[model samples]
Target chain A: MRNRSILIISLPLLIATLLVVMSLSITLGSASVDWQTVWRVIFSKITVINQWVEPDWADTTETIVWDLRMPRVIQGAIVGSALALAGAIYQGVLRNPLADPFILGVSSGASFGAALVFALGWQIMWLGQFTLPVVAFLFGFGSLMLVYFLARVGNKVRMETIILAGVVVQAFIGACLSLVMALANEQLQTIVFWMMGSLSLTEWSYNYVVFPIIAIIAIISLFFARELNMLSLGEEIAHHSGVSVSRTRFYLLILASVMTGAAVSVSGAIGFVGLVVPHIVRLIVGADYRLILPLSIIGGAIFLVGADTFARTILAPREIPLGVVTAFLGAPFFAYLLRRAKREYF
Target chain B: MLTISNVYKHLERKQLLNEVSFNVGNGRCVGLIGPNGAGKSTLVKLISGLEEPSGGTIKIMGKDIRQWSVKKLAQKVSVLTQDGLSPYPISVFDAVLMGRYPHLSFFQREGKRDIQRVEEVLEFTGLADFRDQMLDTLSGGERQRVAIAKAMVQEPELLLLDEPTTYLDIGYQMNVLNLVKDWQERESLTVLMVLHDLNLAAQYCDELILMDEGSIVKRGTSEEVISAQMLKEVYHASPEIVRHPKLNIPQILL
Candidate 1:
């Protein structure tokens, strides 16, 4: 209700922007391909009418479009949306503007899992490139549970305690990860590369795990958007206003943690996508989560897909780390928002 | 419509409310006056179901407070605290519309009737002009009016005001109190307010309940409870208590 046109007009526009970004990213790789060929490749493969537009493009071109670029762009979009949605939920539930997906120990926990996998060299290729992700997902979920239990006092989870627990857990897990890295000699670069985040090697299977969790949680979060608005006011007012404060907080925390876990487990830590995207949506629309939640979903996809595109082609074959590109763009945009919102935003 | 029988509240090492038994009749405006930390706000919280008392029974409309779900209790009771609503980037209309949160079910959006109620309350509270303005841009008086408007839209049988006038000046205090008084009479609403201004309490409240430490010290009309002796004993002060010329109720001359 804060802004109707945001949902009516801005939402579709963001979705359109996402589509364009996805297609453009699919075409802008080191092996350059024209729009027609990319569309032919996508349409033919998606429709299962392979004979419709085949025998024209190279095998390498088809592989680049369908196998490599398609999965990478699509995964980037989903991961971005998941992280940003988690970020918005975190900020709203905690009632803190600076909250992000990694604020809890999920990222560090995932990193620790990856580090252990690398240190032990357990490249079992489980689920065909899913072994490490499954381990990381379990650890990420474990870290969230640990943070929840630590933050809980008797029957309630206070925001300060949650943040404190997150920091404590992150530090502890981060140290463990460093120890694992110290122990590993040959796989240190691989560990560091994964930490930097890249979409160059995204497997199609990551979508199966990340997409459903993100979709279900995002839809449920929309259902609780009004409750989220109440929580932003403060706990007493929220409780007095009829929101079950503890119950609402628990749902949001668990939903955000799972969504964050799924995304970071597969893609490593994509910095600033979660931290910056929700604020961007809030800037364009007002603070109503009805708009912010949906907009952040599309906005995050657009941001990540575009960032990955830039990361992919900026150095041609040698891709820049996705984290570096996100930070380079995100920090300045955030700074600009900060200066402009000095008075207007509160 | 409200009852508290032997309500005792302890916050960790401190006993906040001790044997706090009180009954607010169907359509009465009661004032709770006490020194700081006298458990006034604590009792309000218990009634609103924000916290549970260590021991006791608190009821709204013959039903136990603990028996009411949060949303169900909210349908009958609304609490307003001093500077309660933070200056979030919410429009005045949106902030006031939040009152209908209890009435709407989960996955249920605000209905047309809810919007109508918000509009009515906005117009009633004279916040129609500021409806689209953000909360932070408003003056303290205007913001409190928004909070009252929000409570108005809730349409509760009992309104709990926890030091609702603490942050306002004398003019705003009167404006705010007069609004509540008009609404109380118009709707036969039950209100229990915590007030620091004893004079205002004496003027607006039908009956006054005085608390000190964790126990009720006195309960009567202004003429009965607003004596210099009671002030000295309860407030630890010797301020002169004089009758106001306009309303003929006691006014503290500090």
Candidate 2:
């Protein structure tokens, strides 16, 4: 009851925080727009839906706010929520708190796929403007299937085998990625920048494609939240309590993998958002997925929006990699949590 | 309520149980007493449908166990193992309410009756005060009680316990058995518990099945299954057996 009430209170506060951060994010870019214009442009666009009044503010200001920063902020929130949701499911299904979206080798495979596209320079437009994401998602999901099959001993995939398989697949893909990088020196910058993950290239088109994918997945995952709660206890206990262990594990794996694949494909492997957000949320709220899932979704969006804002603003006129910013913020918090927890979770 | 015949269980090319057979009547508490490595846990696993029997058929309530779906089967049977504690932090109330998983469909949430049932079980188990506390915050005995409460919330017709009191101190052992006994009578629950303590088994169980070398050596009332000669042959220990002064049940003293 206490936990439920805390959730009820914190959820709205988190949304308010997210809105505040997003508004602050829109105002913090290289071109500074006054708070009044920012609010006028937003509220006029919202209240006067079709008849958006020409902002008395400069055209550059309108373009900067609506054209550039808006999509980036939304992408940041989408990618953040997707990765964090996948991480919670991974941790629950594998019964390992350390498990993250990248634990199954999704990031390395995504890098490999994106690097392959760069090396080949095959400009065959498959999925309109987001061809790179499509290819990257397929290859990333392919690598996950490979690791899964390799690690599975029989009907069960042991924890040790999963870690070992992930490491092995990651190393193999890393080798391939380096070979591609060395061969295609001219395309190296494009590949490396994408691998570091940036929201700079985001457009409303990308949002149009990515938002529904993640939102639908997150909503579907909530239905299985209770099964995930059972899975965390132990497989046998879960089975005795009427969870079809193998089926639940399989469905959750697919759901988490799809979310990770989509996020990595678009954002080029944003690290630690998936790993850190769930842990921090679990600490604040308890480990019940019913609460953890929704809270982590909101918490992750807030975190990434705040981090991306800092990334674009920290070294003004020169942007740090979004991944670097997240790692910088996430690693210390992770270390603090590790020291504080003292391997309690392990 | 439960019947096993010629059941065989093998793992990694090693036979764990060979031609094990037993019948547990409805509304009776049966204790399975065995030495270490005697396949007591394996038998419990088979009965609970966690593992399949290598070569025999088991039935429950006159229906073949294999014919029932796992979810439906779980609705009628619940298992309590010693190591069933949640490693993650889960509130006692939420953990106990998970026992209603079988009754709920995929899209269904826990209804009011489910919560009421969990509260009743927690009250019966003396864990009502700790309902909002996390499982990890509870002590060993307290956690065991929570585990029992979780199982009781399942409202199963048959309960399978694999050394449920293995890690508890003696007082907790008695407490656990007393709780199980009280519930057995109140709910008319059929219990198949694996026990290490012969005296406690004799005191609480209506019948005893003594197992050795992955097979049942003897099974009958406490007086028939637990004797000085049988103890010496099965456990490789010479224990003096005496009748309890108040209960008239056989008690083993070493």
Candidate 3:
């Protein structure tokens, strides 16, 4: 039996593309900093010795590179990777090609929490500009737990029930969020901005808060790639292949939800990356999650970094929302993928 | 190789398997012959540990099914269903390679030995040529063959098959059964399968277990169990009993 040798060649190329894309996103900004200077400032800010020559750039440029653009780009990468991996996990575990990270009401529940905060006007900045995200994570996680419990029949949690429960919870919570938006007067604009999903406000400290949560989840998810493959075959078959279906499902769903909640909390339901990147990766590669998981991680980072760059740069000082950019870029690319490919992607 | 001292399964308000007790000897190709809703598939489910019996126990290789960890049990037992794994982006080689799932530990990739085993099984099942083809392109018979190849790679001691040939054409059905018979004879594999075709079941299985209304109607050789009188009593429809031209086994005429 011959395995697909494509993964070996593609993985390295994809990773190299991610590096270049991350660098290009950093370089494309208004600072007029060359790619070489971006590296120099990046090096100087980190290293204590100051290395070689006095930098030609101003202090404000360094602050712009290190403080603003750098965090935003890295935040895009982190949130993108987390959401894409979450989508892959959901698709594998639920055996639904349409499954996304937020298919289970995480966004609506999260937005409800954020909308509540906006309604009450509580901007405490609890963890260096992370007050809203933290509260949103808590409520998003609560909704996932509720959906889990609601979907349980006897001891088993079937995929159909999970989707149904998600639909119910999302519709119910989305209505509540709209109600919050309606009744509020002064904070409506802030709530609307948060709902549109932006990474502009992310700073060095926000990365410090979110990076570990996502990295840990991603590594743990990679370890379960084989299990995910077995799971996608269907539950009864997974049992025949030696997986404890319910238990593995419990762990995988939690892992996906944690990462999804973390992503949504940080960047207010950044859709399309989670929904589209995994599908594109699966189209390019085969159905194996061992390849899909890691490749989605890299592909997602590149995509979001590139999208965020365009989001900030395309409109110049007036910046489009990140979610709008992702939808615009992702939808047509996916449509092209559907029209061109003769082979079955799913 | 497999033991069922006394097992009872209740799905809803009714008992699916009522005080059922049977033991399958090692290397024996035993056929479960029954009408619809007769608990044949339910028994397979119990042995595979997908659902537990309400009252009794099932043991494979002398250890209780409940006591075995999922991976350990899977290494020893493989279950093949009616609708084989199909219509996915996975190739024949990868789908067959998934049989090695139970053997590999967490964070472990399939090694040279596992790949070698998959190759051997694919060759044995005559699937080496179809190795790279997408699963959905294969016919129903070929899909079942791929499934058997996967099961063979698992190297299970006990193979539980539920309705192994429900959708296959007669020629394909014989091909599938002949493959199973060959594998069972060569490796002394413990075989238990629910078969819908009475004639094929009678020809392939060593001993026949007849079931009706959730109880054992009779258990014996095909000659003893497939008689016209017993068929009418249990099935409420009589079919003419005849002998196979070549093998002298009892067959049916509807």
Candidate 4:
């Protein structure tokens, strides 16, 4: 009961924080725009109840807010929510608290695809656009199938074997990626930069592709939250408690991996949001996935926005990679949480 | 009522349970007693529908076990496997509330009655004070009691207990078995419990099935099956068979 009330209060508080952070992020870009102007521009764009005269805003400010920063911030929030939701699902399905979105080799597969695109100079576009992200998503999905097949032992797929198989596949893919980078005459720096992960190129087009897919998948996952709780009880007990163990595990793996693949395809394998946000939410909400899933979504969006805000402003104009910023910020916070947590909650 | 006939369980080529058969009547506490490797646990698994029989049938109340869906079977039956630490830090109330899983729809949260049922069971098991405690925070005995509370909330017609008391002091052992015994009598619950301790089995069970080598060697009242000769032959243990002076039941002195 106390937990439920805490969740109730945290929900609105998190929303308020997200709003404040997002508005602050909108105003803190390379362009110097006043806070009131930023708010007016945003409020005027929305289809509010009353009709108002258009605010006389500068074309540059409008372009920067709508074209440049708006999509980036929204994409960051979406990707953050997707990655964290995937991470929470993986942890619950595998019954390992350490499991992350990339534990199944999705990130490695994505990196390999991106490397191939960069090294081969493959301009092969998909429907005349987004060749790299499309390829990356396909490779990530294909990697999941490969890991699943490799992990299967007769009728059952043990979690340990799946994790080990993922590690093996990831290592092999990493070697291939390195070979690509080593052989490429030039564009080596470009490959390395992309491999490090960035959201600088986020646009409304990318958002259009990623948002629906992730939002749909994440919502579908919420329905299975109870099944996820059953699964974490260990397989045999879960089966006895009316969970169709094999079927539930299969569906959850597919859903989580697909979401992770989508996020990685867009964000170039952003790390730590998936790993860190879920842990933080779990600490606050306890282990009930019903609460944990939605909270992780909101909390993840807030976390990445904050992290990306820091990444851009800390250096100003020369931005560090998103993955680096997340790891730098997430690792220390995770460590403090580990120290503060006295009992094993997972 | 539960019935098992010609149940054969084989792992690869090795036989775990070979042609085991037994019957447990309604409201009766039946103890499956045997030494290690006798497949008592395997038989319990088969009856609970956790494992399929190689060549036989298990029927609950008249319907074949295979006919029931997993969820329906869960509603009718509950099993408590050997105690292990819970991987998640589930609260005691929520842990017991999981017993209502089979009864709940996919989107339905636990209703008021469900929570009330859990509260009653927690109180009945003397775990009311520990209701908000993390399951892992409790001692071994308390965790075992939590397991019982979880299972009892299922309101199962048949309860299958696998090694309900393996590592515990005498007080805990009796506390667990006594709770089962009281529930059995009050609700007319059919019990098929696998017990490692011979004396406790002989004391608590209404009927005893002595098993050896994945087969039932003897099945009868405590006095008929727990003889010194049978113990030496089946268990390979030399034990003196005596009587409980107060209850007038057979007791094994090892």
Candidate 5:
């Protein structure tokens, strides 16, 4: 009962915060628009029935909001929510508080896929456009599968082994990516942009591909939220409690991989949001995955939107990569968490 | 009824349990006594289906444990192993409610009946007030009781406890044992418990199985198993066994 009320209150607060962040993000970009124009653009598009009394800044506002900023914001929301949800599931399955979406080498796998595209210069053959991100997604998911197979032994996948395997695979793939970059001198800027992570290149078409994938995976994960809670108690206990350990684990890994791969395909390698957002939500909502999963989604969206907004305005005409801004904020907080955890666990 | 026949468990090419076999009737409290590394815990693990025996079969209710689905076996037998830490904070009520997971469908929420059962178990375990408390904050004894409460909530036909009182104080130990004894009588439960304290086992158990080197060395009533010679042979420790003046059960002195 109390949980329901907390959810009710928190949902609105999170939505309102995200809305404010979205507004700031829409207004503060290189093409600085007034708050009234931003509001007019949003409301006019939203309520298109009364289009007879159109505002003067309608076309310009539409170009800025619909053509440019809206897709970026939507992309940011989708990617953020995907990463956070994946992180929550990963943490639950491993029963490790520090486990995140990237713990299974999804990012590196995606990087490897991206690198292959760069190395081989295989531009999308059938699909005229939409090449790079598709290749990124495939490679990202493939690497995740590879890492899972490498870590799995018979019926068990130990937590430590999974992490160590991820680190090793990640390092190997990272080295390969660097080698490719060194060879392709002309594509250095492109490779660096992809590596650093950005939302600048996102278009409406990108949103069409990423959003449904994120939504489907997220909903499926939310359906298994309670099972995730059962898993958090430990594998043996979960099995005794009637959970099929292997089946639950396999589904969760696939779902997390899908979410991570989709998010990385669109946003490059945005870190910390996946790792930190779920942890912060856990602090507020306790470890019940049912609550934590949904809360992390909201929290992640708000966090990334706010961070992206700050990134856009803080440097004015020169925009920093969203990943850099997130890392700048996330790295220090992550260190603090590590120190606190050391004190608690050690 | 529970039966183990010719069970052999090996870990890393070393024999952990060697051709151990035992049987117990319905509603009987059977105590498994052993020193450290005697494979008492391993035997319990085998019976609980946590670990498969390398060369033997465990049968519960005349059906081979391997034949029973994990959920079906869980409904029949519940195990409370030695206290282990949980990674996250959970309420006492929710922790105990986990025992009902086997009975619940994947999407089923805990209804009022489930909540009532949890409350009843908490009250019976003398943990009603602590229902909402986080388990990590509890004392060792309290945590042990919570563990017992979790197993009890399963409402199993057979209860298995592994060193349930290891970290408990004498008072809490007695409280827990007495509570389990009362439940055994009320529910007609068949209990298989691994106990380190011989006196407690003597006082509580209907039959005692003394284990040594991963095999059963002696099997009888408390009177038969709690003798000085048996203790000396199995444990390699000399101890005095005497009758309790009030209860007339065997008591031991180290």
Candidate 6:
């Protein structure tokens, strides 16, 4: 009861934090816009309680706020949330805390797809098109299916087998991506940038692609939150508790794959947000998936928004890849968690 | 009521349980006693539908277990396997509440009744004070009790326990056994427990089934099954069986 109440209270606090971080992220970007102007632009559009008027700055503010910053921030939130949600579900389904969005080789597969496009100069053939993201999503999902098939042993797939199979597939795909990178010429930098992950290229159209897919998958994943909780106890226990272990696991894997594929398609290969966000949330709130899933979504959004804000502001006009910022911040926290983990926690 | 007939369990071509059969009546505590690796846990697993018997059938309350849905089976029987640990940190209260999973829909959160049931189980298991504590931080006995609380929250008609007290001190062992006995009497539950301690089984179990080589060697009242001859043949231990001076129950002297 108390835990439920705490969750009820913390949810709003988390949302409020996300909102504040989002506002700051919008205001602190390369445009050098002050908070007052940003607020005026936002409030004038959102509400009539405008204390200040920006008559001449409206178009510029509108372009900055609505056209550029809003989409980027929203994409960051969606990508981060997708990664974290996928990580949480994978960790639960696989019974491995270290499992993340890339455990099924989806990121590497997406990298392979994007690398292919870059190597073939397809983006030049079809400039300003959605082909790259679409291809990335297909390859990401395809690799996941391939890994799933390879991991199956007779009738059932053990957690160890899945992890080991994923590792092998990941290594194989990584090799392929490297080979693609080597074959490419002047476009190597662009391919590497995509591989490293970024939200800088996000546009308003990207939101149309990311939001509906993520929102639908997120809602579906949340419905299975209780099943995930039972699954963490182990497959047999979950089965005895009326959960169809195989079906639940398959759906969870697919959900995680779709979410990860979508996120990777947009942001490339952002690491650690998926892995670290859920674990940090688990530490604060216990391992109730009902609590963990939603909190992870909010936490992921807030974390990336905060990180993206820092990334944009830290270098003034220049922007750091969101992946770099996430890794820089997440690695230390992960290290601390490892150091603090009890002996048997492994 | 539960019935197992001609159950065969094979692991890697080795027969763990070969043609084992048993009948458990309603409101009865049936003790399954055996040495290590004697397929006692396997029997529990088979009955709980955790594993399919290689060839045979299990019936629970006049219905074949295979015909029952997982949720229906869960509502009928709850199994507590030995020393099952959660890999992640979960609070005792939430862990106990997991017993309600079989009773809940996919998107259903634990309502007030579920919370009340969890609180009752916590209080009954003496874990009310530790409700907020993480399971990883608990002592062995406390962890075992939490497991029991989880099982109890299911409110099952038939309870299957696989070495429920394997890791506890003597005090906790007694506490757990006493609690099971108390619940059995109060709730009229049918219990099937795999126990290593012959003495405790002899003391608490109304009837005991002694298993050797994955088959029942002897089964009767505690006095009938705990005989010196049966102990020597089954356990290969030359122990003397005597009636307890105070409780008038059979006691094994090793």
lDDT score, candidate 6: 0.85
> Sort by lDDT, best first: what order?
1, 3, 2, 4, 6, 5
| lDDT of each residue in A113-162, candidate 1, tens digit only | 98888789777654557878888888998998999999999998899999
Rate residue A13 of model 2 by lDDT: 98
lDDT of 3 by residue, A116-136 (tens): 988996777654357788889
After TM-score superposition, the amount by which residue A322's alpha carbon in candidate 6 deviates from its true location, in angstroms, is: 2.2
Model 6 chain A: worst 10 consecutive residues (lDDT sum): A47-56
- For residues B186-217, could you state the per-residue lDDT of candidate 5 as single tens digits? 89999999999988998899999988888888
lDDT of 1 by residue, B160-203 (tens): 99988899999999999999999999999999999998988999
* Cα distance off (Å), candidate 6, residue A104: 2.0
- What are the runs in model 5 whose C-alpha is more than 4 Å off? A33-57, A332-346, B84-87
Chain A TM-score relative to the true structure, per candidate: 0.95, 0.94, 0.95, 0.96, 0.92, 0.93
Please compute DockQ, using alpha carbons, for every candidate against the native two-chain complex.
0.78, 0.70, 0.76, 0.62, 0.44, 0.53
List iRMS (one decimal) for every candidate: 1.2, 1.6, 1.2, 1.8, 3.2, 2.4
Clashing pairs in 3: none
- The true-versus-predicted C-alpha distance at residue A293 of model 6, in Å, is 2.2
Stretches of candidate 2 exceeding 4 Å from the true structure: A43-55, A336-346
Per-residue lDDT over A163-264 for candidate 6, one digit per residue giving the tens place of the 0 to 100 score? 888999999999999999898988899999998888887987878978999999999999998788778777777776777787778888999999999999
User: Retained native contacts per candidate, as fractions?
Assistant: 0.88, 0.81, 0.77, 0.62, 0.48, 0.73
What are the Cα lDDT values of the candidates? 0.88, 0.87, 0.88, 0.86, 0.82, 0.85
After TM-score superposition, the amount by which residue B179's alpha carbon in candidate 5 deviates from its true location, in angstroms, is 2.1
Model 3: docking quality category: medium
The Cα error of candidate 1 at residue B232, in Å, is: 1.3
For DockQ, the strongest prediction is 1
Worst 10 residues of 2 chain A by lDDT: A337-346
For model 1, the stretches where C-alpha displacement exceeds 4 angstroms are: A47-56, A123-128, A342-344
User: Considering only N, C-alpha and C atoms within 3 Å, which residue pairs clash in candidate 1?
Assistant: none
